[model samples]
Target: MRGTVWVASDIHLGEAVPQTARAFYDFLGRARREAGTLILCGDLFDAWIGDDHALRRPPRWLATALDELRATAGALPLWLARGNRDFLMGRALADALGARLLEAPAVLDTDAGPILLAHGDEFCTDDLAYQRFRRIVHTPWIQRIFLALPLGARRAIAARARARSRQARRSKPMAIMDVNPAAVAQALRAAGCDTLIHGHTHRPAVHALELDGRAARRYVLPDWEFDHDAPPRGGWIEIDAAGIRLEQL
Candidate 1:
């Protein structure tokens, strides 16, 4: 589509993250009228186990917010990517909201330009171990097995997994928590796209890198965190008739 799309990632919505949850809700309200599409890069939820997580007796605010958005978003396209945290999301919810689940390294024709969208975690080549593990967990067979587990069990396992990921982060080098510049260039080269937008490292910056002897822009989207001072930064990459603008409202 030749129109503006709101792009953002690393929401990690839920699990008592009230600030982020509220900001996302507000962002959605604005995007409903502002953009042609809403591209949620990944980690839409802190941890989405399955459809049962959505129907739990103990209603969660995130689930309610999602339902409300889905209803209000109307015909606007909702495109989602599977991120490190909310990889468990599937077609069940997608069908409910008319959302599209994007494959890894998906391409989007933004009003600004043709851009490559990724979760950005796979670009952390410095963390070779995580790369290897990501491959295994991403396989169809493994994903199927995980999806078959009871929702309660899946929820429990997810908590433990997050704790383990935290432990690993504490032990690993700082670079492991960030994207590898070489990997980013490699991905851009393979995708044959200059602009790459993703959110994972939580480092929000516009990086200019050389790809195939040509200059390409890689935008790192910031995660939703309210502890910061300045107007509660981290929103969407807004593109209008003029060009792309980062709206931190």
Candidate 2:
């Protein structure tokens, strides 16, 4: 927390993203050597039915990803934050990886300064339908019921939900898919932080603005999609005494 910090998110690692997985493994290796603390902001996987399912029978790709994460955790401090897609990632998975679970919207005190960090989905208040679904799935009782079902049933449900989400996105306007300005301002003000870092929306950039007569910045982390993205895309944010620096691969 007092030295260099590296943050990345939305790798969406899955059976299909072999190239992205390799790239992420490479990033983990680099982070092991160069970063004092590493934070995986969210969506490390495309979907996470449950920790039990993963721990019991991880596929080849997941097993490799877990091994690299465990190695990275052994090398230095590693933290995981749950993303919208991987909201089921729990303490069991974190413990298995030798990493700690970080609650989203955590205020990280770094060498550069204190910054608000999150998976960046809650800020997308404009996506009302998705927000409603988020509320339902986030409900403890609902999650318990879902988790209690057989893994195959859970997988089927998740697949249907994902299909619905994709269809919804196709019909919605681009603006609604991104974060809302008011929501961002409120979060920064409530947290009393000038800098906010998060990943979602897949649009990575640094935005500067004035809030309550004070200058503030929001750093949007990039999503990794090396397999099919035309030019390939992935990146991370590095923070140190030199402040924030964005690195891409």
Best by lDDT: 2
Tell how far residue 126 is off in model 2, in angstroms: 1.2
**lDDT of each candidate versus the true structure:** 0.78, 0.93
Error of 2 at 31 (Å): 0.7
lDDT digits (tens) for residues 1-249 of candidate 1 = 477878888777775767777777778877887788888888888887776567555367866776755854575888877898887777777776778878768877666777888999988888987888788877989877887898778878889988888888899989777888888888888888998888888878888888878888988888887644555667777655666666555
Clashing pairs in 2: none
Query: What would the per-residue lDDT of candidate 2 be over residues 46-133, giving only the tens digit for each residue?
Result: 9999999879988898899999999999999999999999999999999999999999899988888889998989999988988998
| Model 1 alpha-carbon miss at residue 198, Å | 0.7
Quote model 1's TM-score: 0.91
Candidate with the greatest TM-score versus the true structure: 2
Model 1 spans with C-alpha error above 4 angstroms:
55-58, 227-232
Model 2 misplaced regions, further than 4 Å:
none
Q: After TM-score superposition, what is the CA distance of residue 7 in candidate 1 from its true location, in Å?
A: 0.4
Error of 2 at 13 (Å): 0.6
